[model samples]
Target: MCRWLAYSGTPILLDELLYKTEHSLIDQSMHSKLGVETTNGDGVGVGWYEAGEQPVPALFRGIGPAWGDVNLRELARVTRSGLFLAHIRASTGTPVQQTNCHPFRYGRWLWCHNGAIHEFRELRRDLMMAIDPDLFPSISGSTDSEVMFYLALTFGLREEPVRAVERMAGFVEQVAKAHGVAEPMQMTVGTTDGDRVWAFRYSSVGKSRTLFYSTELNALRTMHPELEVLRGLSEETRLIVSEPLGELKGAWQPVPESSYGVIQKGADELGSFTPR
Candidate 1:
């Protein structure tokens, strides 16, 4: 299991969210209250889209605890982006390395996941074989997270993210069942195309990991009128995380079980998720 967060809204310094909150992502990296593990020290990564014609988002990954990385601290202090993703890893069984870090990227899209395939070693070969030949060569890590990203890509992520991911989950479960694994998959996945962000929470088993999205900015302002931070953000601002960044009342809303949500320019959407 791992912990991650996605931010989309006004371009503010990264530290504002990664370090300034009561339980920031950096804080959660060491003391996660809701994750399966208390310390997610295997590795860390951040991916963000700059405001420009270039579609590709920038990536910074390191194979060390995020809280101990001076480089990560320096970068977060000075950088700003309207949309970004940050993850702290906790290896289920894979090696700890930079290439295995989250926020895996292809073209203009970014993705990260916080759960695993129940018996990945037994199903890896079959799942790998199912990936499109042209896309298979791009896989750079051994973690199931990266494989899941490419699997989504191969299943039409660039065209239809929701459908592609549902297909990806369905395919993984199908392979795992063949291998005699009862509960084959568990994931709280977040992805974006530098424009809109999509997040999903689901598992073959009924219970899944924790996930939540921030309450609407306008509503938060009304709820906590004195909070200065809420004033600077736009109504469209949004955040989805593996846990609440803070205990601020009305600041976070749990994503429903086995569901997905999208954060874009207009009204955001929350809906049921079903693997194809």
Candidate 2:
């Protein structure tokens, strides 16, 4: 339902992934080839933690298409971070408002999601009631995407992201099944606390939303030998996106269904899970 990306390697201007590529996030905002929609105009956001910052990531969001937002263009051109999260939304039923945008922030954690809570209207109240009251008030958006974040927080994302997410997914599947809905969740999530980024490609069904991570820099460089920028970035530099940035074969690899990817400096690891 949306397109997103997370970078956890060399720090570069946001535009390098958000706008400059042959099929960057900006391009996917209006011309997505692998999304349900060609144009994702509801809203967009970006969050990045510069080195030395207190894990509280800086975020900028707007309820406008990415291509027409001059401010986002300017921000992308100037900002750089080793880890970045950017999303272009296609709101399933939520209103187009800045607060409803992705890259939602809370303390040191930043999160973004690219799918929906199936038949959300049926479980909105139930899910809301389940969020910790203290954290519930912090939720500023009406999107299920944000609620999912809060749910993960309730399950202990701050202290244990992997377990928290699995618990949250299990709870969601439980609630959905009670309403006679099967596979009521679909999501490709990116979350970080400045030091490491954890991304999940999952759904209640065996099949999940689209998510891909870049091949190792050394390997990708071998394929496109002329792309000079690859040489400057560290071998640890990696990118995870909702879709391939270009027709660059061997440049990206699909995150296996129902799996979570942990991107840390110098190494990438994946953990498999069954969402309830």
TM per candidate: 0.99, 0.96
Best by lDDT: 1
Residues 1-276 of candidate 1 have per-residue lDDT tens digits of 799999999998999988999999999999999999999999999999889847899999999999999999999999999999999999999999889999899989999999999889889999999999999888999989889999999999999999999999999988888888898889999999999999999989979999999998888998999999789988889999999998899889999989999999898989899998
TM-score of 2: 0.96
The pairs that clash in candidate 1 are none
User: Root-mean-square deviation of each candidate, in angstroms?
Assistant: 0.7, 1.2
lDDT of 1: 0.93
Model 2 C-alpha lDDT per residue in residues 70-158, reported as the tens digit of each score: 99999999998898899999989989999999999999899999888899989888888999999988999898989999999999998
On the 0 to 100 scale, the lDDT of residue 60 in model 1 is: 97
Model 1 CA lDDT for position 108: 93
Worst 10 residues of 2 by lDDT: 267-276
Q: Candidate 2: which pairs clash?
A: none
